[model samples]
Target chain A: MGKLISMEGNQAAAEAMRQINPDVVAAYPITPQTEVVQTFAQFVADGRVDTEFITVESEHSAMSACVGAAAAGTRVMTATSANGMALMWEILYIAASTRLPIVMALVNRALSANINIHCDHSDSMGARDAGWIQLYCENSQEVYDTLIQAVRIAEHPQVRLPVMVCYDGFIISHAVECLKLLEDKEVQEFVGEFKPVNSLLDIAHPHTFGPLDLYDFYFEHKRQQIEAYGPAKQVIVEIGKQFSALSGREYGLFEGYRLQDARLAIVLLGSAAGTAKEAVDRLRADGLPIGLLKLRAFRPFPSEELIQLLGGFEAVAVLDRAVSFGATAGPLFTEISSALFRADRRPLLVNYIYGLGGRDIDIEDIQKVGEELERTAERGKTEQLVDYVSVRE
Target chain B: MRQVLLAADTPVVVANATGCLEVATTIFPYTAWRCPFIHCAFENAASTLSGVETAYRALKKKGKISQDIRFIAFGGDGGTYDIGLQALSGACERGHRMLYVCYDNQAYMNTGIQRSSATPLGAATTTCPAGKLLPGKSQNRKDLTEIMAAHHIPYVAQTSPGRWNDLVSKTQTALRTEGPSFMNVLSPCPRGWRFPPNETIKIAQLAVDTCLWPLYEVVEGKWRLTYRPKQKLPVEEWLKTQGRFAHLFKGDNQQVIEQLQAEVDRRWEELLEKSS
Candidate 1:
């Protein structure tokens, strides 16, 4: 096993950064995500890591710098929250299209309208189509492990795409938790040296990044990028297995708890999955065939595996901390519903948009979801296909 | 830029903004650049170059990169003067050893003549059309050279492609500077300025002679005048050559011409004082 220590999500991410010792880290400060860069800056200042830390003016510049550095052929990383991630929208596409393997630590927070700095997946879910691989962490330990794996997954030849490691804003980012951290040498060995394929400094072989593609070729290039995601799914699984062997903690695209022959299940992302697991255990003790499936990799969504897993369940509730605005349900709900559409034996899927803007979600709230799922299974239909959980309404 | 990289005899990386230069030169399956070039986004040329330069430093320290390399960024007025100002200022203040060159074409020519902060007063653009209600752009152009100089970088210059020798020399100086450097070049856009393509250089020369675009440099906080008109021509002489400013010469818009002339004189005097 690895060394065990207590640290918050942001600090743990920074600690993982210290171990990896990236070549460049250009970041801007935003709430709930600032501690990651601030702590990493301390390491840079104390000469603990050989990193070039650039405190950029804004999140747009932060992502821009990362794109430049990565294109120049180096391992680069950054961190940001809701509005900050929104600012990086344009460059995020460029980073991925250019095939720059940049890793970003994204602390999930609600996007601004009423200006609430709380936990939500809206920030990352907004960038789902930006051609980035996204991993959602449940706690500090997962955050640390995911970041390390992100570097490996991003740099893989078949998956040279940017990656975003996301955890809850304040709930996981600020709250301390006891988590196992790999030794510095172990992380260094796992991440290894960054060998750039087409470095900007390689004068012998010149290349242009982010070229303007007209109608004649833009479609083909996009098709090639789509093909690249196929290998990315395989790479993510292989990396997860390798990480599992190293950390003694198993990981997959998603985790299943009491899922064998489950008549009812709750499918969700991030820390809320922990709460759902507790509800599952309590219901199981009362002889209810309930289960929970915690989604880890939202991007490169494990569609086939998910279809197979949910196929056996009679009723499933997909909880999302973000809304799709005008869509039938949230982003997760839409994807899950579409995935199940292809399944021969489809489950009665209900969408639950819950815990937005950092609203508290307790065991009772998840237990209520389980009870509702049971009723939906018994009734053979959902009364409300799309509903809100733990809201004033 | 190709010439500068060729002359340097070292590895060079260029970061370009999303504008005319980037789009015109780099079409998919073909590229004008012979060296490593990157175009991230429109408003982040400087910041992107800063990252490339920072990576060079890190790699050099780790013995991964043994050869010397230089970094440069190019942006248009729209990218450098307005949307990209914050990032440019940050890159300058952070002291990245890279040269940021803004080709001031006065307006967003790539987007078909929209007004930019570098569009001079009384100059017509699609956004600031010269019509009965208004003469042209109501405000004076931003002095980006002065703004860059205020950053106290090692080198800052305002040159024109019309003066080829001066432009080349200033580019060399910027490349050789130890710290951050900035160059604001007055690159005349024939389509946007509504001038004959053949008269691009002549119009740029007229701009310099009329004191509309001065040839000057600021080195380590000290300003130096590189060229001064023997006898400063009236701003009307330069304005009349471009159809964008042709509306200013109409009988009803003569007052607008006077206003532009006064603004030009004020800025010329300020430049003279700073150089002295």
Candidate 2:
């Protein structure tokens, strides 16, 4: 059994980083994500890890440095949130398309306009199409476990794509929780040594990365990258199973809580799922057949499996913390509706764009969503296809 | 350009910015690079190579890497003098063991002769056209080599491709430097400057003779002039050779020409003071 310790999400992430002890970590401090790099810096200073910690000027250079290091065939990592991630937008695509297999810890936060530094999914949600495998964690323990597994997923021979391990900004990042910690030896053994394919340092075989791809071959290269996701999904499942054996905690593409034969269900991501689970339990006591589907992996989106799971539900509500502007609904809502469009038996789906700019979504707000799902199930239709929860009318 | 790497005893890894060299060399199915090359994005060649150098250090310490390797990054003026300055400055401040080379063409030649900060004051670019209303680019060029020298890195040099011996020697010195080093090479563009393809080397040589682009190197914060023309030529000798500055010689534009010469003389005096 692993040792149990009390730590915050950022601390747990730093501890995981220390255990892995990657070759390079280039990062700049951003709100809610600062503690992770700060603690890692401490680890480097104290000689606990042999990491070349680069105190970069901006988030743009941080990601650029990681790309350079990763292409040179080393395990590289960084952390950022909100506008910091926004600053890394251009390099993010370069890192992914180059197949660098870099791992990043992304603390989800609201983007600017009102200049707030609170929890929201707008950051990572905006980067969904950048071709990174994204994993959302609910609590500190999941944060620890997912980061360790992310290294394996990203560096896998079949995957070899960058991974973003995300958690709610202040909700999970600053909140303390009791979690099990793995030993340094076990983690080192699990992560093993990274063997770079066509590393820039390889003197025998020279390779060029991120070449100019015009009309003749850009489409084919992108198609190959898209197909890599197929193998990545399988690798994620296998790595999850391996991680469960080590930690004795089960993980999958998505977790279904009290979902067997659930008539009314709500699907969401990140820490809000924990609150929705509490609302599910309270409503289950009132004899309502309701449950929650908390997504763990957002990229390589488990679309077919989600379609099968929601097919049996009488009514399902997709809760998103980020808005998609003029789209039919939020990001997750659009994907869910599209997935179910081809299903033989589809549920009455509704979207609730809640918790913008870190607005509170308490158990009460989620319970109301449960009740609305139940009502839609009874009526066999939704009064409104898109709505907002915990918002002023 | 590849000869510099070929001259080295160790393996070379190149990180190039997105510009003419990157696009024209590496097509999808074919690549002209004989060694490892990476093009991360525009404006990040220095930062990317910093990462590569950092990885080299880490792996060498871990005994995973045994062979000696050198890292070099290449960027045009747009990537080096403008958008890429922050990344380059950070890499230099951190003292990464790499060499950054800026092929200074003075304009965004790959983007159809657009005006860049490196474009000379009276040079006519597409964006800063020398029309009847405006003579040419109103602002003076940025002094990037001096800016890099301020970083106090191991080596910093300003050379032109016209002087093959000076350019080759400076490149060797930059490659041999232990810490961060920078080189600014004057690369004339035929299409952008509206000069004959055969006159590229001649224009670069004229730039050196006119004191417009002096050849100098700063080693360990001490400046040294690499080449001093026997007798400095008039600025008009260099200006008349390129069509970009031809308008400055026309009616009413003579003042612009005078202003260009004054700025160049002032910069040359300052450089001489530092070198002495």
Candidate 3:
């Protein structure tokens, strides 16, 4: 196996960056995500990485610079949080539409009108349709491991798309955890060399990026990008397998924790998945059939896999840390419900919106959800389609 | 731009902001750029090119790039003087060896004549029109040349396409400078300025001769006048040529014209003082 060590999510991300040693990194700081770039900047200064780290003034420029560097035919990476990601919304589409395989560590934080800095899924969920591969990590280990795999998944020729390696901000970001670290040479060999088909610096064989396409050809280019996502789903699975082999960690698009024969379960993303797993074990030990499916590949939503895995379960609760605002259910709940629409044995789905701006969902809270799912199963339908947890309602 | 296009002795990677230059040349599958060009976003040409230039330096230092490739960026006055100012400032402050050229058309011409920070005092634009209450843009055009020079970069200049030789020579010096360089070139937009297409060069010349747009350069920290008018004409000569300023000659706008003239004369005197 690789070397075992303890590090926080930000440093784990920095460690992954140090190992990857990309050609360029352009980043701006926001709360919760600041430590990722700061730690990486330290690596760049100490001469541990050969990356050209551009300390851009704003998140807009950060993504812009990443686009420029990635177009220049180099491996470029960056990081940002909620409002920072919101600032980068315009270029995020440009970067993905231009098909620049840039990787970023997105420390999820709540987007603001009240201006708070804490964990939430609203940030990346808002950009769900912006044509980027989104990977949600459960902890610091997953953060490091997923980031290394992200470069491979992004740069995959069939999937020349940007990837957002997202982990919970401040919670996983600042909390230290025991994880296996890969050797630098191992990561180098796995990622391989990024040989761009058309580089901006390739003077003889010139290419143009971000051209204005109106009416005639914009649809076709966008359609081609759409066609790639189907193939990208396969690439995510294949890369996960390869990563698992190298690190002795089994991985898939989503993890099934004691999900083999469970009749009631909760599906979710990020750090809450780990908490739900504990809730699953506690309920199972009490002789109740309950389990958890922690979603990892959110962009390529794994609808087909969900059909096979969660379709047979009698009832399932989707715990969302973000509200979709005006939608019938939470963002994660909507996706899960939509995925099971065509299943032969669809589960009775319920939504529990919790933990906005990082309001700590615990094991008991999740077990309570499991008990509610059992009740929903006994009732043969969801009495309440969506409910709020831990918030004063 | 034409002069620099002709004068370039080496291959250049061009970065352009969203403007007439970018939109006009690149139309999906067909591109007019013979060299590598990138246009990321409207307000980030400087930072975007900063990324490309940074990549080039990193690659060259690591011995991946052997060819001598130069970096160049082009942005409209709107991109350089307004929305893109911070990125431009940051790029210059970081000291990358790239030539950043602002095609100073003085307004958002591609979007059909909206007022930009580079739009001068008393120039009519769609956003700031010369109407009953307002007499065109009241604020002076931002002194972007001086603002850029404040970054203490290796080269900063104000030139016009009207003087082809001076424009070409200034471009050569800016490109050859070992650190960041900036050039603000007066680009006469006939459609936006409401002037005849053939009079583009003549209007640019008038701008220089009237002391409204001076031809000057700052090399390192020292200033030098590249061209000086032998007999400075009244600013009215520059304003009256364009229909955008047609309202100024009409009722009650002569005082506004005088204000424009006084401001131009003050800036010109300051330039002369600095150069000497």
Model 1 C-alpha lDDT per residue in residues B1-276, reported as the tens digit of each score: 543454454567889999999999899899999888998888999999999999999999998888888888999999999999999999999999998989999999999999999999889999999888988899988899999999999999999878878888888898889999999989898899888999999998999999999999999999999999999999999988889988887869988888888999999999999999
Runs off by more than 4 Å, candidate 2:
none
User: Order the candidates by lDDT, highest first — what do you get?
Assistant: 2, 3, 1
TM-score of each: 0.99, 0.99, 0.99
Instruction: Provide the global lDDT of candidate 3 against the true structure.
Output: 0.92
Tens digit of lDDT per residue, candidate 2, span A136-244?
9999999999999999999998889999999999999999999999999989988999888868888688888888899999998899999989988888899999999
Residue A52's lDDT in candidate 2: 93
lDDT of 2 at A316: 92
Runs off by more than 4 Å, candidate 1: B1-9
Q: In candidate 1, what are the lDDT values of residues A229-337, reduced to their tens digit?
A: 8888899999999999998888878899999878888999999988888899999988889989999988898899898888867999999999989899999999999
Order of candidates by DockQ, top first?
2, 1, 3
Tell me the deviation in Å of residue A85 in model 2: 1.0
State the iRMSD of every prediction, in order shown: 0.8, 0.7, 0.8
How many clashing residue pairs appear in each of the predictions shown?
0, 0, 0
lDDT of 3 by residue, A92-131 (tens): 9999999999999999999997788999989999999999
